[model samples]
Target: MWLSPALLLLCLSGSLSLTGPSSVTGTLGGSLSVQCQYEEEYQSYKKYWCRGQNEGTCDNIVETQGEAKEKNGRVSIRDHADRLTFIVTMENLTADDAGSYWCRVRKTWYLGFWSSGTSVQVKVSVSPEKAMMFLSSSSSVHLLLLVFLKLPLFLTLVGAVLWVNRPLKGPGGSQPDKEKPSRSAPSPGKPCPGIQPFRPDRRDLQTLDSRAGGQQSLDSGGT
Candidate 1:
């Protein structure tokens, strides 16, 4: 007398087959859309979007039975026979909208008890808060991404600096300089490289030698 959930779903899918994304996500205060595809034979049949876990007992939110496009408050349904698909759009999403939804078609009754035909289950997830501005602006998005990517390197450099400046526990108890000065002072008694030493001319040395020879001759003659 009672049919299981899986058998009921199988019976509903026999008449018409529907295909769509199993799950979708949207941010708070935003909009999301679901596209359902069906066979050409059922494209002319009425299509409806419902909200609930069970397709038979789900509450109908919007249907395209009378018009090609039907809208009910925040939800809208549109059927395109040429494309053999139906699209459901929901705007101003809130936390309450996050739940199981169904895209189904109105077909002949099965065993004089079932009413809906083909169906597909879709799960909607709504974010708790609106997305940040960085998600919308290209520059801001790239900047935030770059910061996240470079965070580890930045932390590593900070830690290295702290480790290098840590106090020494020996005699001085002072942290040593990480880098030494480029220029060092000259050592004592060493000439500072660029100056040249002085030297006497060759002509002065020759004149002194001649004077010494003449004095020696005069002393020998007097003796």
Candidate 2:
């Protein structure tokens, strides 16, 4: 892969350690403020804040020059020396307020382009009553699925395991009779229906040798 000179400079600049609040907790229908600070030494730069409204919608809250016009002093941007930080406070936050936010350096660069910032996710939650109710509803759904969905799969696996290990047995729900020989019922020179035919014994090896004039000896009473 080939990278342009600008992207190469971006990589050399290292991971953008976005200066922002380490963490934030807020309640719904309330006010919340998110702050970001930059650490690079850039002569002339500006701050911009945009909220991820949806898939492609970015609500611009502040731009360096026109920052005051968009937001009623609820937002402030500062870019001096090596720091570019801003604070955006939103009053009467709603459920739709939860989203990602970004701060970027808006100025001409050697690569002749503006670099947009990395994001911080803004989260909103309600107090005990609503939070508890939401958690309880989630747990109930999980429990219902456990009782109805996973149980069937577990039972099927257990049943399959039990069925495969059983021993094979004789026909007619009975064992083959051990008291009487089964092959005796088959006609001579015909293979037995229920048993495998036996192979010749190794004692026949002597008979094969005797046909070539091998002598048989009788034991003497006195030697």
Candidate 3:
């Protein structure tokens, strides 16, 4: 099919679309991996990982020539010709690492500069780890506050129980001595100081008379 130059470029650009996620997240002091897929025809082309807001002016961090794997400092790029995909990895992520990034294919040269080519924008943010740390610190502070608030009440209850169970004291603050019972009977051969001689009452004399009468009656009946 015959086509104008502008139409031809548009067709070429449309056929070189790159597919990947619009955004990615990584934790501080951690690592992250991104996969960018391209067409099979461009599998042998160079693939690069860059960082900047503008895809046309972004600085390349790591790139793989042909089908080789390349590593530069904390960044690495590996291209898989069989899968028509390139993988970019960043290690030891930090707050400074959170920004706009791009995975691009170097397809052709246009007007003294390499064309922006097919790429996907990836936005990275590092807030999840910070939020987790904040929640943990706040939880610890709350636990400490609860302990501090209840400590005085616990001590007060313990002191009251001890006081209620304490032993009674005497006039001099010493424990009181137990009381002893007095002896009802006097010692052997020792008379009681305030005792008088025993005397028989009317009821005792009546009991003696009744016993003598019963004995006399028994003797008469026997004779």
Candidate 4:
């Protein structure tokens, strides 16, 4: 008796579930493959597996078993005689290829068949190409951060310079002169030793008194 595609999918995918390695790592140009298995004998339902990296949507890679065949370039799927077992391959992977994969069972006629899922992880390992990209991008980010930080520092420095150069006011609020007084004072004249009041111009006092007396007598006689 021919089992309905839906019942077969449920048996292999839902009930049995495909068993496979969840993750694998390889280089950019390296050949990569993933494996999965189901408990029941496959009864002719189309089987397909998809790959999705980093939580992205799974993309169809391979198809086999009963009514199965669908895939994009770079992905291949093959099933063993047991029908539930599958081997998946991807080639020439870039960083974008890294992600999870799911093995699915479906009906060729309508979406009727039941389905199961298995994971696929294609990791393009460390290479100079990726390393260089990381360094250059990271360096640019740091440079931008430094430039932004310097703006505030530069403004602060400018403010300090203006503050130092600002003019000061005097006590009466007039503009103040900046010049300071010298430490040494001017010298005084030499001291004279015990000297009395000295008069350099000396005249005859009696002659001056006689002239004054004559003038006074003439004035008295006239009066």
- Candidate 1 deviant stretches above 4 angstroms: 1-16, 109-116, 134-223
How much is 15 displaced in model 4, in angstroms?
Answer: 7.1
Residue-level lDDT tens digits of model 1 in 88-113: 99999999999999998777666658
Mind sharing the TM-score for model 4? 0.39
lDDT, candidate 1, at 7: 93
The top-ranked prediction according to lDDT is: 1
What TM-scores do the predictions have?
A: 0.53, 0.39, 0.60, 0.39
Task: Estimate, for each residue in 11-91, the C-alpha lDDT of model 2 and write its tens digit.
Answer: 555335455654455565467676776555432455567666441256766666533334644454544433355566666
> Could you tell me which residue pairs clash in candidate 2?
none
lDDT (0 to 1) per candidate = 0.84, 0.59, 0.84, 0.62
- Estimate, for each residue in 1-223, the C-alpha lDDT of model 3 and write its tens digit: 7899998887577445678778888888888999989987677778889999998889999889767788999998999989988899888888899999988887776663765467778997765586688899999998887788777788889999999998999898988778867668887877796987578999999999999999999999999
lDDT minimum window of 10 residues, candidate 3: 108-117
**What are the per-model C-alpha RMSD values against the true structure?**
13.0, 21.5, 9.0, 14.8
Model 3 alpha-carbon miss at residue 74, Å: 0.8
> In model 4, which runs have C-alpha deviations exceeding 4 angstroms?
1-16, 41-43, 53-57, 65-71, 107-223
Model 1 pairs whose backbones collide: none
Which residue runs does candidate 3 get wrong by more than 4 Å? 1-16, 109-116, 128-131, 134-223
Cand. 4 Cα-lDDT: 0.62
